[model samples]
Target: MSAFSAIGDPEEAEEDEFTPGIEPQPTWCPGCGDFAVNNALKKAMANLGKNPDEVLLCTGIGCSGKLNSYFESYGFHTIHGRSLPVARAAKLANPGVEVVAAGGDGDGYGIGGNHFMHTARENHDMTYIVFNNEIFGLTKGQTSPTSPKGHKSKTQPSGSAKDPVRPLSLSLASGASYVARTAAVNPNQAAEIIAEAVEHDGFAHVDFLTQCPTWNKDARQYVPYTDVQDSEDYDFDVTNRQEAGEMMYEVESKLYEGEVLTGRFYKDDRPSYGQEKRSTGEMPEEPLAERYYDEDAEWERCAEQLIDKHT
Candidate 1:
């Protein structure tokens, strides 16, 4: 039996099981959207029948990084933009653990953009949630990567001249097998999207619009969102890359224009990076964590192999 077998089984999971015995009250300001994210994630895990011990939540630096403090699970608060790489390593080492990486837009799209792109390109089996509040909340409301052009902040006092990063489009272009957008205002939709992302076999990116009411008072609260899947006004096949691309372009463009479009934008039935590596015999059938416990197990020293190659 595996050492990790003690992790609670899904059959015995309860909604309250995810809450820490001594729950820490979130320190986010009154009306902060971060609260909504915490609630939705817990609800989603419960709905999916996932035990806290079976999941790993990795968060990057920023207000969004505080998620690990409140969430009752295996958590890692990584440096800015470094959450994805850490999450990837954990997932590769223990394929049975459900890995979820999260961070703010600046921490993710700006600092960690390279990791994000490559992770998606590799189709790593994990869920990535980007809390896009348009401004740096914990850093005193600076202009973030997702901040709209002409949006003023302490860093961009003259107003931002650069166009905002298009998250959904970027995720699709970077080869994320599953992509979606949700907002804090719509907890039900957010929970549903998170659950779907968690269940997806390949890289899943969720652009979660969280309002920084204190920092970005001018930003939209993402209210009155139109669910593309349920609305007739927007008709595009999520499985069709071209159709999804076109739809994402429109969605990204209209976000700052007072129109909020939210829902699953893209999905592809593709083998994850780990799955492909295993098929190619590059990865062992047993998880690395399991193999490490065997005293007689022969391990390949990758560091030695690299040094030998260079010498």
Candidate 2:
């Protein structure tokens, strides 16, 4: 056989309506919570009818970052705890494209917590979804920022000494325009939540309570947050930010207690980062390219400076 094999047709036949570059199977372990989370993301994109090229899926380091390789759209596997900043920048650079930031709880809450707070307050035009599995799934079951108090792990052999970080209350408090919570087990609800986030104009955030079978607690005992209201007298009106924050604090403060309040916790129509940016700048006449990279001499000078510093 020739070392360089040739294909019969240069172009792919029977083009799929969706992008087909994501052919390689995922590397996540079987029955991983990420499976449902990833599926929900795909369905959300499909529901939005967004072009693959116009959708940027940016992820931070950890198992969640590996999600970039599973998507056919424009994706960036960013450094640990830096996905928000990159996603924010991407949305600012191209307001038309749909930008999403994904990462594990440890990566988002532990290291990237500051970025998360600022992004929410700034109301960056992007959807940020954090996979909350409690423990650090990628680092062989180390205690994460959200790991329940008294929960024993590799790092916390005698149980976690610190309190578990609550994302729902924190996001709402930090001024995230659209805030919500969901569970990976309920794929349909999760998908719907993600779709709603994409439709929203301002900063939308959803912390998915994903179950790590190999690393953490029993998946069955965990109640997956869904939009469905319980038959047993539990009210969940997430329209008001104050009410949402209170409800979130009530449910999320205790470890695995209370009904999982899953729905649009908060939403607002305030001016987005994109709108503010548009108001500040005059519309370009000859396209952004003409203004930015019109001169070859300017590019050469910048490149020479970079080469001198690095080389």
TM-score of every model versus the real structure: 0.96, 0.82
Model 1 lDDT tens row, 49-98: 88888899999999999998888899999999999999999999989998
Model 1 spans > 4 angstroms off: 1-3, 6-9, 306-311
**Cα lDDT, model 2, residue 105:** 96
Clashing pairs in 2: none
Residue by residue across 107-186, what tens digits does model 2's lDDT show? 99989999999999999989999998888998889999888778888898998888888888889888899987788768
lDDT value, residue 41 of candidate 2? 82
* TM accuracy, model 2: 0.82
Give the range of the ten consecutive residues with the poorest summed lDDT in model 2. Answer: 1-10
Error of 1 at 169 (Å): 0.7
lDDT of candidate 1 vs native?
0.92
